[model samples]
Target: MGKGPMGGGGPHGMMGGGQKAKNFKGTMKKLLVYLKPYSISIFAVILFAIGSAAFSIVGPKILGEATTTIFEGLVGKVTGSGVGIDFTYVSKILIFLLGLYIVSAAFSFVQSFVMSGVSQKVSYRLRKQISEKINLMPLKYFDTKTHGEVLSRVTNDVDMMSQSLNQIMTQFITSVTTLIGVLIMMISISGVMTVATILMLPLSAVLISFVVKRSQKFFKTQQEFLGHVNGQVEEIYGGHNIVKAFNGEEDAIREFNKLNDQLYNSAWKSQFLSGMMMPIMTFIGNLGYVMVSILGGYLAIKGSITVGDIQSFIQYVRSFNQPIAQTAQIANLVQSTMAAAERVFEFLDEEEEDQFAENPVKINNPMAGVVGREFQEESNKKSHHHKEAEREVAVVNEDEIIEIEGSVQFENVHFGYSEDKIIINDFTANVKPGQKVAIVGPTGAGKTTMIKLLMRFYDVNSGAILIDGHNIQDFNRHDLRSIFGMVLQDTWLFNGSIKENIRYGRLNATDEEVIAAAKAANVHHFVKTLPDGYNMILNEEASNVSAGQKQLLTIARAILADPKILILDEATSSVDTRTEVLIQKAMDNLMKGRTSFVIAHRLSTIRDADLILVMKDGDIVEQGTHTDLLAAGGFYSNLYNSQFEDSHEEAV
Candidate 1:
């Protein structure tokens, strides 16, 4: 089966929406820790925001003075008793009002610039932490989650938090400051009119609460369905070939339509409800304006307020309703920010792999003994064969390093992917240094699990794995893994040049060494035929090359690593018969002085193996040399005979 974008699982395998923060208050408190480092920047943002609001708030009142000056001058002109229209005084008020607005704009610009920087810095730090956390997290943590899910925490969630933070921080401060400042200014102008504006607030509040409450669920459902739609698209596209091969296009389209329909319904309802808020509030605000206008005209007639005061009160009324609307929107934004923060923090808080052992045993040049010397001689012979580029073998000081003969012992091992299902039971094996042991088994016989356990990818439940009489756990995980090189059925190559991909096995390997390793794996000839040769770039999926070539490249990588223990899991499965023969020869040369564990489905390839382990249902039923096992006429005989019988039937 072809793997989907999310490792073969469909949309239902992904995290569903409505995943709001369980403890929003607590998550916000934790998010404050990230903000703590930028407290000064945030404080500056708040101050600037307040300054912007304060300056802008005073503008209308100052403009009111200019209006009052013009009004008095016009009255004096009509009465013919005083100078008409004091142009000088009005000009001064107009200039002062312009200055106030300029200062307000300046404050707003500074705050926006500072807050943007702070938000990006926080995002950068969180992404960096999550990237580092991924390396420290246990493999088990990843096994349960899809790749898209983990990536969403890094990309989608972080972006959401950052964008929301950037907008909300300045918006919240400015809204509150404007609300309070405008209220005070309104009261100064006319308490009676201010009270009239204030009375409309209850109606505004009731309307806002109603819209927000009704729309919130639809918004959440929209978000959920949106995720589902995205997941379906990603999965379908990623495995489009398989879908077509099986004629599943109609089914795929049907599923997509189902999700898309839900998305449409939720999205429109949410948008319609949210869109109604402003218009509804505007109607109520207009009613308040009518009331305030009548009150202000009465006060003006009775000499209780100036025309300028009435103008200022009206401006304040518009300002007042805005903050109330923004406050409701900010509440929703805060919820989203907290939810994003919670996911990011949750990923950061995942259980990490125990990387370092207490008083860790350090193994140095484990192949520095007799096996190392023989391997060096063999490598020298292979280097001589590569006339274009000579191999550069690392020479280590034997005196400073302890020799690990690559002898492995699995003592009464028991393990499962989970605690409830024991797939490997009472497994025991002993492998001496430089032995070529082949494990042959039916599918689901725990062949791969044994290798994983040997490498400490997953520790055995009740027994210990030992290398040279030392428990594997005693060694640091990095140091322990360094002893082995693996080439599996599924070959992995990243998007890089062929040379870089091979050099990944040994980062410090020289160009000459890489070429030599490629030649040793029988990859140099085929690589030379390709465009750009070793410099050819692999695409993201590495699909530019054939499957067998990819497998060969991986083998070349392992050869370059020159590990003390070699693991070959259906390593030559992708290659043709002739290419397999060539690869098998190269593998024989590579395995000469290293302890090798070869898991093979084709039994013919391993007839010369020093030990053939026959496993069925998680238990090794037979283990001996091929000749010995065949002579026993037991489980190995039946398995060996059955394979040949199938081949003969196909041949006939």
Candidate 2:
């Protein structure tokens, strides 16, 4: 859970503790724009709140009328000049007051229901938009922020905004209405007492302002430390095993305690200061009551006001201070809400990846109809040697289908994660259709970077990556990606059944097709052994499966995709020697008619590659066949020889 605006002490603690927005007015304007659709609902809430406050405010004044009636009747009875009391009139007043309160309560309930709906609707829209926005955001944006930080904006910030908006809207209107209504009622009772009550405002304001100013820094500190604490806990929890293995538990605990102590210090100070507000305001309110009582008594003695007027005046004075306090609390809440809004809007406004091309060139697979039919005929001729179930044919509409031969060219490609540092500089490569090209390099040789550029995860600072002679950027990103399949060193499997995870490659694939793809990647036998067979659910981390098994599942997914181009970035790195050989055979079958780029640190695996590109410091220093590279006795020869030496030494 993310931290909200108000921490341990609740709303009162947040009176002056909430962080202020950098651009309060601008953020508020944007928020109002977002609320435009709910304007009518919000307006209804305001009207209902005012109506509720108005009825509730009128009760004290009307009840005072009954009080005056009883007092006058009692005095008359004592003098033996009139009836004792007007019980009938007092009863009527009480009945009317009861009806007014009932109506007020009904209005209050309706407004609350409406406002609750509006706030929830707003939250729903925000979450939906944020979820959508995440897809559109550039990969670069996520590179700079943690997953937790991003998630906090979605969960905590949005939640805070929704809750605060709900309270602020209704409470603001009600408080203002009550303050004004109470003041009017007080004036109608007696001008002198009203003036006396009004005098307490300045003193109350001074005390509040002083406390707020003094506690503002502590509140800010508290919020900052709270985030630090949450971040630390999340980080440590995620990597607790690593920390323990490294004997860093004491360090982690010491760091946590430091942050915890700072949070405690600031929290207590802010909470204590904010907590003082009620007592301070209460003292001022009590002083106002005393002043009003003295003035009301004098006025009553002079026959300038009745006992009922005095009673109403005192009630109005009490009501007056409440709205003032509520307004103060609301001000802080509004600020907090705006701050959360700013963070949400900031994410929504981030630069999105250019997903679509203005004039997209449709993919035209020339081999779909004529070549495909010929291939099927060829397979039928060889049916005696191969099982009928092992042979497969794709039936696609010739008019709608388009495919590329998977020819790729990197023409003077230059790129860097940042402009100041050029990693892949003026790199060039050409891969023929259906050719297996191996990329071998050291750790930071820009091997993965090249794949990223080819996939358009990031564009080159200069030069072009062409697919089937069309610049990659010219094709729609989605369309370009559709022709490619990737099985990376780090396998990613979502929390789903094994069958569903495999089907993720092609969502509409039938169970038979999924099983065929799994069998092709050599994962079918292992999956069948699981407790629920293909129905076995992988946990969130997929920890139930071995790393090699995870890799095989990903390979099965890629096979299911049946991409025109295949990228295997150390795809068999995690598997044992036997499994690696099996995977290599599966990969060989998968790569037969597709342009495949294999990134491998194990030089032995890529011995059969059509072309080996030896890269060093971002440039391909040598390009040749395995035997030819060995004959050249250059960088590739040295790297291959070193690997052999390491293996030989290990065996010895």
Candidate 3:
């Protein structure tokens, strides 16, 4: 709460022992923008805020009158100035002030409750939008930022903004209102007393400004340092085994200590500044007290003012200073929360991909000199079915089938993650419907990159990708992604029943359909042997399931979806020889009547592929049928020889 456990001071990325805080007005302004949608809730909070503030103004005045009445009653009874003592007036005023506090308390509760509910709902909407945006963002975005840092923007930063809404708006309005009301009372009571009382204003203001500036800097630094530490912790958690294997315990601890120290120093500065606020103010308050006593006392004795007037002036001075001092303490919390707001707003501002496909490429539309007599007789029926099939697989459309041709073509494509690095250079490929293609390569050879491009994960820099005779880019993104079922090297499984895991492929699929798909993938037997069969509760990421089992489950899930274009990346890489053989058989049957792309490490799977692209350094050096490429005496020949035919070590 006080800049957390670690301390660093100054605006984000500041270095050294101390740094000055920036003005908080700009940060606060940016934060208020998120509240625009909840204007009604904001207005409600303001109305209550004003109610509480007015109650506060009335409270002290009532209490002061009660005190004056009691003093007059005690002194008047002794003198017997033809007046008897009466306690009823003082007690009634005290009761009225007490009632004001009770009502103010109720308003405070309502303001906090309503504002928090509205803020949380907005947080949910913003997070959902951000999640959808990232889902469609090009892979380049994540490459430049860690998953943890991105998560922080969603979870931690958004929460910080939400948590501060009540404190920021409600308290700020109440304090400001109280300050104005108190000043109005002071100026009316006595002109000379009011002027004299305000003389201490300049000194108190300087102390507050200095402390607020210092605290804000420290708090901002604290937020940045905490984010850095969170990112580091996430990385270590992901690679804990690898770290321990490499003897990185000491290194990890040292890195943590460095982050710890920055947190420590920043927190120290913020609290030190916050701590000084009260004392410096108290010292200034004491000076005002002494000055008012001497001046006020002389005026009272000279009959220039009454004793009650002097007492009330002293009371008014205390009321004004107390709020200013209290508000100064939460300044650090306000600034730290505001810094987090900036990071969250950055994510909320990211652009989303195109969603509409009102006029996609027609089956009749074709590139110059590309369409031929071979497609003439049945092209219309084929295109109609293709679009309908695509619509069916789209997640958003449970009942309608999206139309898209299964045929795909990359035409002289050039692309890269950034200006400095070109990943795909002049790449071109053609996949007729229902062709089984295999892409093999060494690490960093753009094998996966090709698959991503086919899925429209990124747009080509120069050329176009076409499905059937139409450019794929012209199609709706939902329709485009729905047609392909992808199973990556790393598997992700949600926490749910075994049946639910398979049903994730197509949410509308029946339980019987899921079981049938599992049987096709040879995973049904394993599920039956489990304690609860389809209803068994799966652990997070499916840890209870073996790695091979996890792979099989996901594949079965994909089979249920029955995507026209199947992407199996190292589908058998994790299983043993026997299981791999079983899986390979299941995979062969699965690929028989549908277009498939396979990336496998074992040499046997791709031997009969319609096309095998051997890639290295982001370029395809050889492409053809297995028999044809081997006969060509090129890069493919050399690769097959080393990988398969130790017997035939032929010189190129």
Best by TM-score: 2
Task: Single out the weakest 10-residue window by summed lDDT for candidate 1.
Answer: 4-13
**lDDT scores of the candidates, listed in order:** 0.82, 0.85, 0.71
Q: Which stretches of candidate 3 lie over 4 Å from their true place?
A: 1-41, 80-84, 212-221, 303-311, 326-342, 361-405, 419-421, 644-652
**Candidate 1 lDDT, 145-250, residue by residue in tens:** 8887888888878887888799889999999999999989998888888888888888888887787677667766776777788878989999999999999999
Q: How many angstroms is residue 640 displaced in model 3 relative to the true structure, after the best TM-score fit?
A: 2.2
| Candidate 3 lDDT, 168-286, residue by residue in tens | 67667777777888788777666777788788889888877877666666766776777677667867877999999999989998998899799788778776766676678889988
| Clash count per candidate | 0, 4, 17
Query: Tens digits of per-residue lDDT for model 2 on 1-652?
Result: 2354546654545524647689989888878877898999999999999999999999999999999999999999999999889999999999999999999999999999999999899888889878867865777888888786788788888988888888898999999999999988888888878888888899999999998898888887887888789878988998999999999999999999999999999989988887888999899999988898898899899999999998888888889999999998898788778888988988887876765555555576332333334534654354221123433333345464345889999999989999999999889989999999999988899898899998888999999999988899877566687788998888999999999999988776899999999999898999999999999999999989988889889989999988899999876666788888777777877888999999987898889999888888999889989999999999999999999898899999
Return the TM-score for each candidate structure.
0.90, 0.90, 0.83
Instruction: Give candidate 1 misplaced runs (Cα > 4 Å).
Output: 1-19, 366-401
Candidate 1: what lDDT?
0.82
**Where is model 2 more than 4 Å wrong at Cα?**
1-6, 12-18, 76-79, 364-401, 575-582, 648-652
Using lDDT, rank the candidates from best to worst.
Answer: 2, 1, 3
- Using TM-score, rank the candidates from best to worst: 2, 1, 3
Worst 10 residues of 2 by lDDT: 383-392
Q: By summed lDDT, which 10 consecutive residues of candidate 3 come out lowest? A: 364-373
Candidate 2 lDDT score at position 72: 96
